[model samples]
Target: MGPAGEVLWDVALPASPSRLPGATMAGFADRGRTPAGLRLIPPPAVTLALVFGPGTVVLSGAAGRGSVVAGLGFGTTRVRQAADFSCVQVRLPPAVAGAVLGVRPAELGGAFVALDDLWGRDAARLAERLSETSSWDERFALTDAVLARRAEAGPAADPEVAWAWRRLVRTRGLVRVERLASEVGWSRKRLWSRFQAQIGLPPKRAARLVRFDHAVHRLVAGQEAAFVAADAGYADQSHLHRDVRAFTGITPATVAGEPFLTVDDVAWPSSR
Candidate 1:
């Protein structure tokens, strides 16, 4: 129970070996009736939430307002319902999100949209399927199969863009954009345009987000802010503070205490 006597159950689902690359899933079940909500900090990957409970889950952010199903990518922090909610969160690489969600990452960048608006009737069918199933495992299986089918049916990202995204993640966003562009045989301008169109954020901002994600986790792990700043490639402690505030509207100390990040290591052990 929380201070408000709220009960929250968190379930982390292992990625099935058969699942598509660059996709991960988790489940959250909150039973509190306290009109609770949370500030969802923006991460590097695109996010999709499937809500299948009596409680309506509303998301307000760059993408705008929505309830039931929410889609967010490459944007500012979003506020979502925190109690009386049960849902599954799917994290997808921006490259594949366009294929799976029928909308480019750039379209949803820095905003929230109703999933039904994007997926149409398929979204309704999915909600019904998930709600009808009593087993969490069943719900996960259904979602994975749906995503796999959609991804296979939709167009894949340009090879150059996909390669660049992988490299960014591999290097923790420390690699130079120019270097990545050259390696991918794309001019800097070309890379920037395509990346923004496909992945939502420009290369430079994406790198910062990826690096900031690393630093935030370290802080949540109890590392000192100065050390995390230096290690994360920030110019100084103040730089880290400014970046954290920009992303989460909070200071590093406050970010270090976020329950969302604190539970991440346990829930997504291989998030890095």
Candidate 2:
């Protein structure tokens, strides 16, 4: 949920009775004359979205329905929403995504796949079941069950790879990839390849994505670009500018005004 002039939108957590590990949930709806299109800036986690309603929800250039899984830093995306619609969006940790999705997150990077393709008829069943639900709480419970089942049955990430990923996230991506390899007792090449296979991106790019995510939020909070650059660990404002452009293709000021980033602000202003 984000940017444009005077467009209205809303964000909410799922109704109570929720339980999922390493997954953050948010529900979205249109209020008033929402914009025809919404941009999705890259984020640091994999995304799962369930969309239903009279209006169409387009992702990137493709119109989508049912459920979809998108990889982290999936580049610039646009969602066209209907006048009346409801979406339950979830962000999953990369390792959790690997287990639940049954594929390397790298396979989904820079792209999205319909859950139907991956889950087959089970995906269709999920869509139909969710559409029939009488309450949001029921819908969330069903979703949690499906993901929990997969996470339990699927293979886990290598412990070293998982630990290295945790370090990158904990450090806000400020940790050096070289140091990660050394600390994990693996050669740089081994770490890089394994990290990419398991996490959907090379260690360095994932770190950049995480760092950019933190820095961008500060920008949205009204901090100066220069200040965000320094505090967020960029070498300089120019470095920050380059990273911003690489991810969003817009300057810092333009990215800051984005309504997508502001939706969470409207729902949880304290998050900033």
Candidate 3:
């Protein structure tokens, strides 16, 4: 799933039978001997990474290392491992971040925090349990059960904000924020404030992030930049390039070759 001469990391998407609301997907990646580091570009959903690894998960410029809860990255986030690693990564829409993690999306805003900070003893217990598991399937089941239990103990998002977030996702980030406010029967100001508080990004920025995500997948699919720009509602190729570079710190051509984006079709099939 990588370019020529690139080490192919093994990635598996394990199905979550629980159908937990607001949870997008969960995956297992065991990058054995792949020296390549990872840059997690801006995506529409928050990310939770739990490591039961052969190596430590280190974030750029951070003093400590551990499993993390990352908000919708407003910009590029770098992750590196010194050696082979095994971990379960979960994608949670903003609506579920609070319920499943007991924190608002805004709390994680634009940064990655050690899961131990948020989950305390529970985080350590889960890591120990996951490390003891013999297979990925067993780890996934345990992880899903933990999320379900936490969700029940935490607060859910405001119904209106939740609805608006779903609409943005369903539309692939192409819908207008004003229109969304109207549809939700909230004034534009109210919608803007609440969305920022709960979802961690303003409605317009969220839309742009989601749109950028869509364009990234298209580029990875081998679509021409001009066509992807036009189809994704960008003003032109330059605008699309600007957004891609802003989110990923690289040009469209480079992003197209990124193993992370290229492998997403298999790792996140339905999302692609």
Model 3 per-residue lDDT tens digits across residues 10-50: 66666654457756555555555544467667668888888
The alpha-carbon RMSD values of the candidates against the true structure, listed in the order shown, are 2.7, 2.5, 1.7
- Compared with the true structure, what per-residue lDDT tens digits does model 2 show for residues 10-57? 666665533555576776666755565667786787888776655445
Q: Which stretches of candidate 1 lie over 4 Å from their true place?
A: 1-7, 33-37, 61-83
User: Residue by residue across 1-272, what tens digits does model 1's lDDT show?
Assistant: 22332434556574464277877788777656323345566667887888776656655543322223223333344445444667778888888888988778787746767787788778878877888988778888898999899998887899899889989988888999999999988899999999988888899998888888999989988899999999989999999999898888888998776656666765566685
lDDT of 3: 0.81
lDDT of 1: 0.75
Against the true structure, candidate 2 has what lDDT?
0.78
| Segments in model 2 whose C-alpha atoms lie over 4 Å from true places | 1-7, 15-20, 266-272
Let me know the TM-score candidate 1 reaches against the reference structure: 0.90
RMSD to the native, candidate 3? 1.7
Angstrom error at residue 263, model 3: 1.6
Best by TM-score: 3
- Quote each prediction's TM-score: 0.90, 0.90, 0.94
